[model samples]
Target: MNTNRTPNPPRGDGHAHGFLGERAELVSALLALTVYLTGLILELTGNGGPATLPLFVAAYVFGGFFTLREALLTVRRGRFQVDFLMLIAAAGAAAIGKWEEGAVLLVLFSLGHALEGYAMGRARRSIEALGELAPRSALVLRAATPVEVPVEELVVGDTVLVRPHTRVPADGFVASGTGSLDQSAITGESIPVDKQPVADRAAALADPAAVDAGSRVFAGTVNGAGALDVVVTRLARDNTLARVVRMVQEAEERTSPTQRFTDRFQKVFVPGVLALVAVLLGIGALTGEPFADTFYRAMAVLVAASPCALAIATPAAVLSAVGRAARGGVLVKGGAPLEEFGRLRTIAFDKTGTLTEGRPRLTEAEAADGVGPQELLRTALAVQRLSDHPLAQAVVRDAPALLGAAPARSAEPAAVNLRAVIGRGVTAELDGEEVHIGSLAYADSLAGPPVPAALRERTRQLAESGRTTMLVRRGERYLGTLGLMDAPRPDAADTVAELRGLGVTRMVMLSGDDQRVADEVGRAVGMDEVRGGLMPQDKVTEVARLRAAERTAMIGDGVNDAPAMAGATVGVAMGAAGSAVALETADIALMSDDLRRLPFITGLSRRAGRIIRQNLWLSLGIVAVLVPATVMGMGIGPAVLVHEGSTLIVVANALRLLRYPDVREARARR
Candidate 1:
């Protein structure tokens, strides 16, 4: 290892630009500006003549250092870029004894590049901040002894001690201890999530619905109150932060349509401009125009028509918007997705986790004719309290609220002689009678192989409606049936409504869930279409059908959602903190399960597209005016100033996105 110096903090790309590469541009720009101002002031004040020649030459060297290097590198690679055009233009102006005009061109060119670099650097700060959030050293357990080691040295299967109030060392399951974790760093969850040991990796992976705060903890999230022994499931380099950064790096290479167009335009436009400048010079010679003046006009025209502003128009806005989205806990993969997201009028949602709360909740409670509602609920809660099944737990939670005609807190039911049948149901003694609370099958075996006709019908209706049914019986007499369902999230309906208000023409829900369950959720969320009982491939087929007609985005949160996500115009993964597959596969990742981020980012994308168009038109208009004006006797200095000024304006316009409003801020204003 090179021990001479400490490495800079890792950015999204895992490396930073070298000092001379970054500092040379900024420092050179500043130095060039200083020298140019000095010479111009001297000439303007009438205290300068031939004495300012050396100053202008020094200014040119300071400003053109990086530009010259870039020109040479591109030439060596058998290509010409904007830098080559810039270098040639400056040289031509100097050749005609117009050193001041040439200095202005080079100074502005370098300064514009420095500002562009700054914008790009700011765009990367969000991801870099996340990478930097992880601890530098992990307290590893070797032979049960705590040893501090660099996080990079950590490997899979290593155990790390996560002390209370400190950030987690790596992505892993909680092997021991109980506490709450502040996952705001990774998931944007403001509330601290209670956590407990969950060492079964396979079960957690197979059932991500069971993977909650207690099951999987990500690196960078703060541990709360209690210490935890975490088993490292991923290497430091392959943690969630690293994966997000790697994908962002990959996405950067896939630019927007406008950027691609400008790039192609430059390749042909540069050579064509060079040829046209030659024609203009030839025409001037034939007309007996002064040779020095003709060459100067050609150089001015080259600088004016460089198209630098047009080239940066799309990327600046895209990068700024992407960075802004990142700050709001939405990671847009690239320019393509950002632009596509803006134009999206249709989105497909997965039912089980995407639209619903993703966990069991009580939906219905029907008491028998003889039993009071409170008695039925109290007895059911008493029996279910002894069971750990998800449906039972949901009933135990929901029953207390319904004990009254007008739901409010009340007395607890006392149950004794509790017996829990694993993965099935629970039985207990309540009010001196044997009471059972479990699945219909389990209840039938104990209460009635043929229960009350009305009760059975109610149970059947609940099951057919996509609810998990739990029957309550006391002494072979059916008391009531409780319906458990994964209810729609509180924000789901609002999110769909906001999308509609944003001009979304279609809203679809595609799920692997039963047709009834999917339809129920779709109706609850006001979706335009509902396709249920879909396997992963079926979801992909639906997304493809949507793609054939209009731009569609697929939103989901599982390995199953990955393929459909890839099949759509843009794939978005909700609640990505706990799922590596979703994070890697989706084009956009919402760190939290906030449906509101959907509308916020969509609006952001549209705003970015608008700014990109504005920048493009402004840059193109300036170029159109300058090229003709320069050829028709406008001086080199003003032509260079106007051209560079437009590039600055484009960058500034794009920079506005860096301060774009998030949903909360937008709501507050309203």
Candidate 2:
């Protein structure tokens, strides 16, 4: 969101013009003024006089010369566009001695085209701003000193230091430091992630091993309070941000079916109108009507039947909607993607960072006899202090009131017999007593007795509620239990309901977490289906399956979710906590990580699309009404006025999409 990136000013020397090209607005305004003044002078003189004809010719040249040239070139290339129709209609009017009418037509059409171009340019600029999200430079570690270098200069195996408050330069892992990282830019989760060194090998896991470090972190994520020495893995060109830009560019290149259909319709429609006008003139001549009257009427019919309104309708609305979405912090890749959003009947969301907070929190605690909950919490906090596990950290954070001024140091080795059971918990001995902390089943087995009904019920309830339950014991004696939960995001339920209201019929939750956890979250957020315990590849497969069934939208915030996001009909990324891969892979990015905005955007897109269709129909209807009326000996003047006026009305109606009411409401809620 760096809105203040100074625009490159147009150069006066004209060696090369910048994007603005020296205030196109001023040039257009001057042209409009000239046309208006000339029209006024012609009206003050006699309307059908030779003196007014030259002024009309000048106005026509000034207003539509470029359009005419372009249209001719396109026609020669076998691409008969809507612009060609406008040029032909203006030329036909001039040939029939309706010079004033021709000039007015050119002026109106040129103004509409210029306005559409400006709207499209604004949309393109907004999309380009998204390309600026990644930082250009990175701090690389050479020998023992850190050096600032362009991100592209860094390569695989090169050590880079990412300090607190700085974006990670490229995808890599933590080499020798421990700290929290706010990966919201990549993952869309609001919470920060804690990083630790991989502990499987020694030499292979050197204090600064390149391979392991290169496999963990991602670009565009923020390093927190701790410093990390990372090895660059991906090249700048292959980074997530670059991939997203490429995808959007590709999408832009593909034309929508609607646009193609309109083109076909215009080709046939224009020729048919000309034939009808010719037949009408032939009938008038056969019936012995005035020849001049019949010819003028036929020209009117030709002018009126040109599909000017239909041509402007769709593109204008698309430009407006895209602009509105960008201003609201959603980066919709293009008009087609925006249109697809309106058709989304089913939406599948990733669990860790989609429906839930994606961060662990303490949910339950129990105490042993003689050892109060506070005492047990203090010991657990002391032991977990050295670990970077999110669950352990959550427990430590929840019991801060129980911790004394002289906090237990995790750096201090626990009493003898300290051991961590994989996928269970930790165990240690303190003060000559053997302490066991693990799953309820593990503790019950060690205790060698039927578990108490109360403890069993408590454990089952916690487990079913999607909590990670840990049992604390003293040797063969059961002491207490702890429960941790990754709670649902506060707005998750409301967002799901709103999406449903917006015509999203089916919603699914997809996650890498366990089935029970995913199911619990799914129910909480009103998901219609739940798929869990999936790897990155599995997510891609699931999305493919969903696509086979119906058009699907995948919402996620993890590096693991990238493939699935790309595979879905429409992909939405949580901008705040999403991984760089997810952000760059998604078709649309919710920049602020507010899920509520999803429904609002979908609604706006639907409304915009409807308005576009209405404008098209209205434009066609005007042509349909005017063409028949003019061909039956009606005057050319009124027909020309109606045609130009209808085009202006359609263009203005389409532009109304730029100010969607739902966008304002969504922002107000924020």
User: Candidate 1 lDDT (Cα, whole model)?
Assistant: 0.79
Give the alpha carbon lDDT tens digit for every residue of 238-323 in model 2.
76555544444444444445555776787788678767867977999999987756666676677677776776666556656765
lDDT at residue 35 of model 2 (Cα atoms): 65
The C-alpha TM-scores of every prediction are 0.85, 0.75
Per-model CA lDDT versus the true structure: 0.79, 0.67
Per-candidate total of colliding backbone pairs: 0, 12
Quality of model 2 by C-alpha lDDT: 0.67
Candidate 1 C-alpha lDDT tens digits along 424-529: 6778898798887778788767634457788889899998888878888888677888888899999899989988888788999987777887777888889989
